[model samples]
Target: MIIKSPFTELANARQTPPSLVSEYDSCVDLIGCTSGQDGAHQAPGSQLAAKPHCMLALPGARNALTNAALAAYERYQMGQPDPRQLIDVLRFNVFYAFAHNAKVLGFNDDWLKYEAISPFGAPQPSPPSQPIAASCPANMKPTVLQMTVEHHPWIDFLPCPRMRDNFLRQVRDKGEDAVDEDGLCVDIVDAASARDPESVCLVTWGKPWVLSEWEVTEPFMKKWAWLLEGCTELMESTNTWRRKRGLHDIHFVH
Candidate 1:
């Protein structure tokens, strides 16, 4: 028995090209045509396509594209900068054009077979949590903080432990006067591992400062503000994984 496509009315209403609609129907039939004993729609094979592959197919593709378009529209409504909104809108247009091109080129069933055996096609396991100790002493001097970082056991938890050595070397080469006057210090690891800007006690011989204590005149801010912003973004993304494990929220002083 032949089944009527659910997309028929949608295709007619949207005036979608016949070729594209036919391609969509084929994809739906390939993946969602069969139902298992559990009443869940299963692909012909045991393997399900990775999330991205599924998202690019049939009804999933339509929903994903629509969401992308709506996000761009919402950005415009919110009065975001024109350039930023332009990027968002252009992203939608580019993906829409790519989808059209893919439809015209025809579908490849072999791609599914390849994806089924690929490691990337499976969901990745979460990285094991490596929490840093909360041992930052209050009112610690910058030099003492540096020393503590050099000898501290938690220093090993940094993504790049070599950064600690580099930081120490730079501070030593710059001399104490430069550190005091220019704030020539770096946050080696605590801001990332501890995931709290306030817990950042591992800094060079300069002003003992937290993220909240920003000074425009400070040389460190003038030179490394962008680096700090980048690190904050990384930490924020890491917080999602941390939250799943019921870990404390990563705090940024500012």
Candidate 2:
């Protein structure tokens, strides 16, 4: 049985001919015509489009979310494993879009992890149970705390012994030049660095997914200064660039 979207009136009320309008309209039309008509009215027309291949828009808080879900599903069917399931993909896409947009808007750091408060540059308070005194030297008087200085923490920590051994093996295979920053791998390093800033795609979980940024070289973080935009802005920016190049946005396949 066909189910009508609860947002049908709201969608129509907006009257915005955004990029996803056609997709929504197409799906809505599909829902209305052959919702409960069984397989009898299954044809390609305004009144009978929802047939054996009935494509209902995925349930979501917004059409953009649904569109992203559809895109993720399409990508998964094409062999991308990051979006291995529907619900996970939907949640990830929403969060990704939110975080990406936030970075674009100048909130470049994670809100929960990174804090910006008064007394700038001062270290944040650690939990009482995890006192710094516990790790201090015996000669240092923990009771009468004086000025103390410590080396910066190492950011990269190899947690697994096997992984570390495997890394060393790989390094040995590559020779002394493996650890050199400006050695024979300079070209590779330069290529990777250059592509990060020059590429017009969003990277999620190591896989590249083309999101708006078309014609733009910088990542979304460096391009925009606010997270107040959504799919419409993305589509507009990318579509405008595509039109300039005599191309159009690619369609999603079921």
Candidate 3:
């Protein structure tokens, strides 16, 4: 089955040069392909696309939700958990993408779960929810959709207990990369601050994912008047710089 993001036209690549998949961890790995942006190959199929893989909402990409769905399909074409098994997501915010992508991939309810997790400067997930797929209990809140990511899959909340305790703590640690002064959070977890941007990501969720700044915002730090007060921006850029270098974007689309 070929699940393509509603946007991005890497379908030609799969038939031509194909792409590469690197081991992301013991249970997961990274798949790379060409995209519309200045990135590598784009696997637009939602079923095949794991988080961190990104697709551009280029002029054609804005075709409602299907463009993102195409990105998921690219990932699906590569392969997945085979629907009858577990799809390991160590720190994935599996909300809108999981639900919509699961539906697209023919996944039933049992195939997904909101597993508990904890990573550095990140927070443990819910007893009832994680990101996209909601818990079964009737009392639980159902899933919601957003463009910005609360945490990249590389962000392991299981290691960072202290930061998850407070929303602000998460903001101070991990949310810096994604959050902006206008309250829009973009999920550009560059190498520098990628170590911990949990809170920052959450605050900026529900907005478009931007590489740097958009028409309404400037580079994240520039939007924050206090960036110069303590030079936290420069400090974080230095620390996070190395991590974003070889990084690739995965689309957990809807």
lDDT over C-alpha atoms for residue 244 of model 2? 38
As a TM-score, model 3 comes out at 0.22
Clashes of each: 0, 2, 67
List residue ranges in candidate 2 displaced over 4 A.
1-75, 79-84, 114-254
Error of 3 at 41 (Å): 34
Can you give the TM-score per candidate against the true fold? 0.18, 0.18, 0.22
Of the two candidates 1 and 3, the one with more favorable TM-score, higher being better, is: 3
Error of 2 at 59 (Å): 27
Q: What local distance difference test score does each model get?
A: 0.26, 0.25, 0.25
Q: Which RMSD values do the candidates have, in order?
A: 24.9, 24.0, 16.5
Q: Give the Å error, residue 186, model 2.
A: 44
What are the per-residue Cα lDDT tens digits for candidate 3 across 27-122? 122121122222221212112222342222122322323333334444556653222111111012222333333343223443222231122112
Residues 115-197 of candidate 1: C-alpha lDDT, one tens digit per residue: 22111111342211222123432221123333432222221222222323434343355442222211121122111122122
Candidate 2 C-alpha lDDT tens digits along 84-154:
23332323332343333323223333221212211111245222222333333232111111111111111
Worst 10 residues of 2 by lDDT: 28-37
Kindly provide the TM-score of model 1 when superposed on the true structure, using C-alpha atoms: 0.18
Number of the predicted model whose TM-score against the real structure is largest: 3
